[model samples]
Target: MRKGKLYLIPTVIAEETQAVVIPPHILQALPGIQYFLAEDIRTARRYLSSLKVYESIEPLIFEVLNKNTKADQLKKFFEPVFQGNDLGILSESGCPGVADPGSLAVKFAHEHDIQVVPLVGPSSILLALMASGMNGQRFAFHGYLPIDGKDASAIVKTLEKESRSKNQTQIFIETPYRNNTLMAVLMKSLADDTQLCIAVDVTGKDESIRSYSVKKWKSIPVTFPKSPAIFLFLSH
Candidate 1:
């Protein structure tokens, strides 16, 4: 029997922006995928249903794959693929395997011999970088900074030092609720001339992507929103 392919599916970054961010091809590919690994099964069902591609999603099989998913349990998750059913890995937001936990499955697919396909869609990281007007040629994505204020501050400063020397754009994200705390640290840790870009709600109606120096950011007296956000900075 032929083996199944692994599809790295991308979901919308914001709510109700499906038509704006999801392409026609992604919808076309959905009818053939009945087995999915998602961060949140309920959200995955709702998202797929919103596309109106299926008469009923009741027949679909969804298995959890999140930060808590264990490496030892991945073999069982891939069983359907081994049985010749194409498997789709869905992220809670953005492209699967980029900053999402879907990377674990992708790595497992590679180790086996499954063909991995990535569907094009909005990625908050890339979208933010595109709008930030930062150094696109040399950029690094540090997934999440340390949660502790002091540790996060130290890491930010270290990244800033590296950015200055290498002229590379440093990118990172913060948990939605911790947005304000991270923003405060960024303002406090970075230098006056260091350019910072805060891209919030990328590809959404309320999308905002602004770049300013740390000195300017200090004067703005702004409060970060409780929404998915990307932070990028360049120091030269």
Candidate 2:
């Protein structure tokens, strides 16, 4: 009989950077683990090292896509998680499956009746929404905007108008490198007085979050931060 192992999932939230709270729970469980299934193997190693843990952690790559290769990836990646061997699912940044990789593994675990535990910590999306000053009751994370050079003008217009009509905060994000480009599109396409919020490097040493009207960013020449960030547009 195979003994089912409990997974000690770690959140890559900003608060987890220090050796405290939620991170310690996962960090303590890393030693003598059967395996480690991570979105990025290198990042997982770094997180372990940051905590002064020197266990020989094995790597299992998990994907977010829905292709055949994705299933193979999950099988190859998360097989140990179900068979009584503890395998931790970690996001490169933030919580897994919340705009990060690891949902597929969770789904697999659930399907196989494997207990999945999520350790809570700093969440950039929730943190951004709480600071947005928008309607908290009604909100949607639209993930990343089009990256294939799609009409960003039309996308922003639609998001702005929809938010205004529904009285909801439309939240979205982009890659760290394309931060400025998204800001430009938001200013040009959205209304002049639209409220925009940018939460950059949420829990890091250089963290910054600014909320202002679109017009305010105009004169300021909004060059979005190059660090990891979350942006939200409010219409209330």
Candidate 3:
């Protein structure tokens, strides 16, 4: 029997903007996917239902795949593929197999000789970089920085030093609730000449993308909201 292919499906980064951020072709392809591995089954079902490609979501199969998922559980998640059934991986937001835990599934598929196809969709990381006006030619994404006060500051300075030395853009994110904390550390740690870009709610109605020098950022009195955001910097 021919092995089924593994599709890396991308989901909307923000709610209520699915039609705007998700492409028509992605919607058209959803109807053909019956098996999915999602970080959250409820939200995954709701998102698929919103696309309105299926007559009924009850027939679709969803299995949990999150940070807590272990290597021993890979066989169970990809069982359908072994039986010649296509499988899809969905992230809680943005593209799967990125910063999300979906990479494990992708690795499993590769090991089993299952074809992997990544569909196009919104990725907050890429969108932020595109709008940042920073050096996109050479860049690195550090999923999340240390939350400790001293550690976060040290890492920020280290990344800035690396960016200056290599002329590369350094990108990172923080938990929504800790936005202000991280922002505070960034403001205090980075040199005044460093360029900083704060892209908040990309592809959302209240989207805000601002690129300014650390000096300017210090002068501005701002408090980051509890919303999904991306932070990038480049040092001279």
**Best model per TM-score:** 3
Q: CA shift at 95, candidate 2, in angstroms?
A: 0.6
Better of 2 and 3 by lDDT: 3
lDDT per residue, candidate 1, 60-170, as tens digits? 999999999999999999999999999999999999999889999999999998999999999999999999999999999999999999999999999999999999999
Looking at model 2, the pairs that clash are 3-84, 4-84, 5-84
Give the residue spans of candidate 2 off by over 4 A: 2-8, 11-16, 20-23, 54-69, 148-150
TM-score of each: 0.97, 0.84, 0.98
lDDT of 3 at 21: 85
User: Candidate 1: which pairs clash?
Assistant: none
**Cα misplacement distance, residue 165 of candidate 1 (Å):** 0.8
Q: What is the C-alpha lDDT profile of model 2 across 107-190, one tens digit per residue?
A: 877877777777776678998888878778988898888864457778878888889999889888888999988887787787
Where does model 1 exceed 4 Å of error? none
Rank order (by TM-score, best first): 3, 1, 2
lDDT, residue 90, model 2: 67
lDDT of each: 0.94, 0.70, 0.93
State the local distance difference test value for candidate 1.
0.94
What digit string (tens of lDDT, one per residue) describes model 3 on residues 1-236? 88888988899998799878888888877887899999999999999999889999999999999999999998998888888988999999999988999999998888888999999999999999999999999999999998799999999999999999999999999899999999999989999999999999889888899999999999999988889999999999
